[model samples]
Target chain A: MTDCKLCSLEEYLKLIEHEEITYAQPHKPAIPGHVLMIPKQHVAIIEQIPDEEFGKMMVQANKVSMALFESLQAQGTNIIIQNGISAGQKDPHVCVHVIPRREEDGLNFLWVPKTLNEEEMSTIELRIKENLTVQLKPKEVEPPKPEKVTDDYLLKQLHRIP
Target chain B: MADMSPEQVEELKEKLKNMSPEELREFQKKQCIFCHIVAGRAQAKKVYEDEHCIGILDINPANPGHVLLLPKEHYAIMPQIPDKEIMHLGITAKKLSHALLRALHADGTNIFIANGVVAGQKAQHFMIHIIPRKEHDEVGIDIPEKLLSKQQLQQVKQHILPSIAKSLGARLQEQPVAVEQVSPKEQSAVPAPRHEPREVVIEDTPRKAQPKAPKKEHPKKDQTKDEDVTLDDIADLLGGS
Candidate 1:
């Protein structure tokens, strides 16, 4: 097994680096304006990423997509996340691919939609409903305040500790 | 309306162009079938629902448990969404991905968003497609490798880097002074200092060592010129005939 390239992140061209996420251009990109929003920490999959971290990535992705549209004059953009191995995830690290799309770009994300019977659809729906717990909400963006300890307060705390 | 004459399409496009943003949104909501589905006015097999988002099984699913997670409020594209709402939708997508894995026993999932008609965005309302995947399913979304020359990559970087920085900088300026002060890490990592071209080829050797990457299905279609899809096509999608 090889080391995760995203974790090192030394080689990739860095674009916008936030605390939780690093937006960069892939070394060997699928397209010219293709960029990736990757978590700073080594998170293996989307399910394992913290909600706040994932949220930050998505927000950055939107910003990047907007930039692609305005700056590159890209006609469209695709935000794609291949979550696990079976979904064509080349890297173990969770990275969101933001590709700038032009007309005749030769990249097609369109899939042949398969028609499922009523029974299958209903069964899958029931199963998904049973497993899904959808109460997860993004918490209000409040930066944690570190308590300021004055010199006098530290001295008093030291006396109390003794 | 898909069969509307080009002249009629032109007329509708003109009509859409004249409307205000608020009016455009209202018109979009009226035209969008997904908005109706989100509002519970139309029928869908909903798998999950909360205050901000709803998840329903895709009628013509790529896979068995394919889910379309949509925001309750109608938005035309991902960029139109506010930061808070986009976050909510993303977290919801993660949860739905988990649910698909747990319920369908699927091997993987793909979280997909197409922002314009050119990008395969069929509906006016923005939604996230969470397609459950298995081995050899043939829902080929494998991005073909199209490596850019170094100069081309640099040009792309030059174009995109400032745009992102400007957008983020504007947001940061609007934030509280304390919030901006806290992220010295972000301040240090801004794009200006990193403009020097570093050795990119050195890192290529390590990535090349990993040959165990899964074989992707390259569903080669005869490449067709689709430059006909214009912003008017987006307006047509928003009109939702």
Candidate 2:
């Protein structure tokens, strides 16, 4: 089993720079300067990560983007994450791709659409509408009773060296 | 020791019980403390509160003094919001913006609404981001320029007009009894009939003053002018490409 990478930011940085992790691109050599912000834990996808960790990841991603701007002189950047195979995820690791973009670079990533028949289109539309309606409908929920974890204890646990 | 009275707790519980499932989900996602605060389970730095909505300081702000305006009854996007709850969220955002300007001494502000996941909406709950903007702080928000053709612009205008009209119709329905009772004929008689949408009419009138006149002298001027206009604006005018 792959060990949890959460404790060592330095080790995580090294792995990102090593280029073997095909799922995430390293900041150096590829796009001149690009960074991949990822959870050190082996979380398969965003849905699997806890809410607090997810929020912290977002904050880190933002910080990395800011660093890219300052260091690389990046004019623009794109924050992308491929969740499932259908969304083009080749790896199971949950990571956010931070790609720095420049003006008139001809880096086109547009997707070409295949035409669908009228019946097929109608079927897809109907299915989506039905799903949305169902999702909006109310459901019973068990009362939310949060576990008592003090801030100090949680902080120490999160920051502990592996 | 209790911060809120028993009656206040009961009032909050009643509101929570009446909330739709979608609203509850939104509250769970966006207003993290609302559920905890309501249950007397968490303490939060509350900025503003009313029966329908609440404003609070964002724990992790894009900039200092960033505030979030959330509806007590949750809806994801502005379009999904009910007519009655319209002014409540918008007014709260406006008030917070003013407060940020006065208290934080911000240069400008951006009222951002990321509607869905595609739009970078992290929280499923409908929340308005009252981000206080500074002149030179690199926040990493980039707006792509899209070029559009004349035909696309016309198509978009045609498609959106009906939806805009429907929204206006819904708004009119919520007017006071006497105002609602007035027929289209009476309304028209009261105000001059305008072809443009009421909202558009107010904003568009200023543009008519600066009529485009073809300049014959400098050929370089035309090239520079084209460069000045953003590709996004062109794309918007032409419809999405």
Candidate 3:
């Protein structure tokens, strides 16, 4: 954790402290007014974080975006969270980019065209639809281990009492 | 640019096999410019910060006042993100969008996420792009016209509907869950964190939350200007644009 800079970014970035997350600027931003919203904890993935904490993270991101519009002369905005290395995530830390837009800023985020045929499109849509349907179940609470406090031990106590 | 050469794909795949999540995380930490900034090893033009996330200026932007929001912990990608964190991130992005409107008096805003390398993603970290928009902005989102015809769209819909229902659950089955505009106290209790935030986005002059449209782009950024720009606005923008 000590080696992970994300765990210790607060001192470096002049952050607006909050109850849940911190807001600051990116060192090498793709655009002006770029900012980063980081959770206070050292979580590697969203799934690993508690649901409520994750909720707080989103609240913080939305708040920062609102702040940008309120304080700066912003026109339009983009909020992006790249999830995986395959998804173009660079740092191990998770970041949401809230980019401000105006007429003709000319930053092309376009990718090379790879037109999917009808069959492929159908396939892809189906995949997303399928995956999107799956709900995230609440993690099951683990019972205490047998070594720590086993049902067998309780049974033995019950027999001894009888 | 999003497309990689065959060798590049092979190389990446090979790298994946050799790298454990921890090793990959460390590798990313080492090369992560954001982390270095958080560690005081580098510098940044900041915007704002709180306990959970950081907002900072983008050096290269599609428009002025662009901001990047990042989580303090290391999360590789979106699919890997838990549902709660996803919701949290989404809400924060919306507020930041509103912030840009209030502060800069910009026209409209766009929230973009390139999920994969093929989707124009260049960063290994998760980043949400909050961009302000004006009429006829040269920065084109460039989504091609309908990829499927009406009949095809129908077929795709039918194929996906069952799974969408199964996975998305209540949100899709019923009215959308209003995940935005949360007041602070409504938030749940959080323990002290291990990650410290870095970077800052200074508000030259802070403004209160207001619903007025931006001055630069005229006649309301969206047709429903007076109305609250709900999360659906972004979805509509992406769908209709």
The prediction achieving the highest TM-score against the true structure is 1
Docking quality tier of candidate 1?
acceptable
| Count of clashing residue pairs in every prediction | 0, 12, 168
Using lDDT as the measure, the top candidate is 1
B1-241 in candidate 1: lDDT tens per residue? Answer: 7999999999999999999999998998988898899887999999888888888888888888989999989988898899999988888888888888888899999999999999999888899999999989999878766555565555556446656666655322112111111111222332222222333222211112322222112111111221212233322322321
Q: Estimate, for each residue in A7-69, the C-alpha lDDT of model 2 and write its tens digit.
A: 233222221221112112232212333345556566665556654455444334444444444
List candidate 3 segments past 4 Å from native: A1-162, B1-16, B170-241
What residue runs in model 1 are displaced by over 4 Å at the alpha carbon?
A133-162, B3-14, B170-241
Residue-level lDDT for A147 in candidate 1: 92
When sorted by lDDT, best at the front, the candidate numbers are 1, 3, 2
Chain B TM-score against the true chain B, each candidate: 0.66, 0.54, 0.60
Compared with the true structure, model 2 gives a TM-score of 0.36
Best by DockQ: 1
Q: What clash pairs does model 1 have?
A: none
